[model samples]
Target: MEGEAGVSVPQRSRTGLRTERLLLRQWRAEDREPFFALNADPEVMEHFPATLTREESDAFAAQSEADIDRQGWGLWAVEVAEGPDAGAFAGFVGFKVPRFDAHFMPAVEIAWRLARWSWGRGFATEAAREALDFGFTHIGFGEVVSFTAVPNVRSQAVMRRLGMTHDPDDDFDHPVLPEGHRLRRHVLYRARSAA
Candidate 1:
């Protein structure tokens, strides 16, 4: 709503964001444990090769913090609104430029990763929509893209819900993953800006 003059709600800055049922905000001290646990969960990391160690998790959190501080936007720490899980550390959703070359370099990728409990609640989709809104309407990005291992049906479903369309022609092997890794081959999905 900040796009229109005098209409409120500032564009999401490095601080964070809020949706109808969630908060796509910044890192908090208390979020470390659950965030680490979420990253360590085998089921949660199933699409990827392995779960991260606590040190790796901490490093990721630190990197996420720095990215937002330096770039004004990055994966945001999320919190759900009032409910049993109210004020709880849910997960993150937002934008980041991938650090590798693919057929699709120099692109903004919208992503989400929530705790197991946060699943089935639509929080990923909700927070992602807010992030995309910020990217397109507030930041004026022309298009945003997402990619995942072909087996990650759930994330693909969320991408579809956000109006992203997949084209098999854009699929490519994720450069960062080790060669021959099952998840290296990924499907790309794209969405035009809402602005």
Candidate 2:
């Protein structure tokens, strides 16, 4: 189906979406271990305050699944849809509503967290493009935003590749982070619906 932006909408099922190379779907029992590893990897969690413990990782996954179940969309677990690693749990890529209030609160954010092996590939950008399309076309959101710590140029590059624009004026200190924290100041990027 054609969306308001005249872009072809991706095929979607309840709690799932398919891109050219990735499947954004609900969390699975098999995804727990790898997800925990991803969250615990200091390299992966470097942009955040700290790595997640196994329990914390599991709880986050459980909440993501429940969010998908209740709203038909949330942070969907991503899997390689085709290739040698087909069906392998890579990580997650999808939408999230930031719980804390900020100048950008009450907005949906496009985000991703992929395993280290998935880096250097176009998976994050590809999956995030589909998620953005779903949000604009299916959810009918007028805009979606993404943000990261000032040092996270990698994620900012993904946002830029997705056509999201960044404005220095829109930057804000993350409310959840303590004042003076290294990751407290964040750069916000926004993508507006073509409709």
Most TM-score-accurate candidate: 2
Q: How accurate is candidate 2 locally (lDDT)?
A: 0.89
For candidate 2, lDDT tens digit of each residue in 23-134? 9998999999999999999999999999999999999999989877766677999999999889889999988788898988788888899999889889999999998888
**Model 2 segments more than 4 A misplaced:** 1-15
Which residue pairs clash within candidate 1? none
* RMSD of model 1 against the true structure: 4.1
TM-score of candidate 1 to 2 decimals: 0.91
Model 1: per-residue Cα lDDT at residue 85: 79
